[model samples]
Target: MDFLENVVSKERTLNPEERVGEALRQAGVSITITSITDVFAFAIGATTRVPVLRSFCIYTTAGIFIVYVLTLIFMVPILSLDERRRDSGREGCLCLRLPADYKKNRCSQKLLLEVIFRRIFGPLLVKTPVKVVVVLLTMGLLGLNCWGLSGLKNDFDRTWFFNPGYQRDFVSAVQDLFPESGYRADFYLGNTDYFREKEALEELFNRLSALPGIKNGSIEFWHHSFLEYLKEKKGKPIRIMNVSTKAMQLTLTRRPPPMWICKQADILLNSVPPVGAMNHPGKISPGLQYMCANG
Candidate 1:
């Protein structure tokens, strides 16, 4: 053939397979695009199969649908008008004069993508049994979700997110080691009038302590209201005490100066931990110390 390569000593015609491969390569048909698509399809398939990722896939697909709908609503008319103009031999932009060669190059890949999408979703959406099964399953799940939501509580138990293995082991260890004594819940109240409202505050504390979940006599308020404490003193001036805005501070500790647990408007209360199983510190990880300190 005229396309045969010439060597110094001899001339050899290229193999048919080699010639075809070369032509395909020059036309930009190569493994790179196919490999990318294969990998992407595998990843999407794998992700869609996972329970957690399936929701994300569904949401992303819905978002894509929304974008497509928006594009159709806003862009189809403009595109149709442009096509009409082009057919009528009217050009708006100089860039339109050049044929979009990239479209030709991507024809095979476009066809492949179209085929893959149709194969993936067409039968499931079109077939009677498949569609029925999908609808029934979706309705069943939706009903289950509604039933579950009906029992949802206002309080969130952060322990639900703890590692299962760690939680099981920790409960076993705690049950083995300290079956008699468990952790307690500490509640803090700020902006309290401890001294002036001692009776009311103490009543609230007693009521809280009496709750079946709270340990008996474990409830203790560290800060007594200054106004209330002063009123009890035998010789305290009634007028001065009534006029004064400050409360006396008392520290109860091992050192000479005990840490006053209360200031003018703040109060600290320490009590038995709430008796809920979820209140167990073992259920919380990484932030156990922070929860204990702040919660």
Candidate 2:
């Protein structure tokens, strides 16, 4: 306003009508949208330009609404599949155990009978075809979840993912760097910062490496080889191990030793907390299904 007023006042000789037109030009609208790709491109472009439109604010808003509505529309079937999956979970989390540990289970005999009846025949025999449809749909969804979803389901809900892809990619990257023979587990010497003593890595690696099947699965040093590379290039050889002390996050990784080797190494590096006063990043492991506790 000040700039326009200054220019308008610049000429007392100019007509008032002409000054009004000059001020109008200065306050004129602006628009920019050049890269239009497909049908989506044209829709974005044609609606954006308007007479005396400052920025096509309403069109932008409507565009956003359109996107939201489309997402919800496409997502409806996915949600229905999800509900079916929930119905299916009753079958999945439901384990048809042989009551072998029935004595240890909290449920009494009557309660156990009720559970079996509820889980098995309740849906299978009694429910209508629609419910059966839900069962089949759920089975299909779960199959997709396990086989197709990869870690994508976690993006939808964390609980759905078995383990984050961070673990998968990290493991794969490590495997690529240091080949895992064929073992399913790896030994980790993790602490805060994870690379406590650069040399300690070789110790644990060599120690765990001696284990037979573990040789097939690679041992990923949270720090060793990287340190050697770093130090060999005159970079950092050793740095303080930054253990996440507040939370006992025992950060470690190891290719699982053969079942036999694991039986032996439990003395040194099983799930037991290491002697360090500080806690390590705990409660997480690549193979969450296994009993190997710490790294």
Q: Estimate each model's TM-score.
A: 0.32, 0.19
Model 1: per-residue Cα lDDT over 125-189, one tens digit each: 88899889999999999999999999998653334445778886776576569655444454555
lDDT of each: 0.45, 0.43
Pairs with steric clashes in candidate 1: 184-273, 185-272, 185-273, 194-225, 195-225, 195-228
Best by TM-score: 1
Give the residue spans of candidate 2 off by over 4 A.
1-181, 187-201, 235-295
lDDT of 2 by residue, 58-116 (tens): 46555665655564466434434433443333222443333333333344324565578
- How much lDDT does candidate 1 score? 0.45
Candidate 2 C-alpha RMSD relative to the actual structure: 32.0
Give the C-alpha miss distance for residue 75 in model 2, angstroms: 63
Question: What local lDDT does model 1 show for residue 149?
Answer: 98
Candidate 2: worst-modelled 10 consecutive residues by lDDT:
28-37
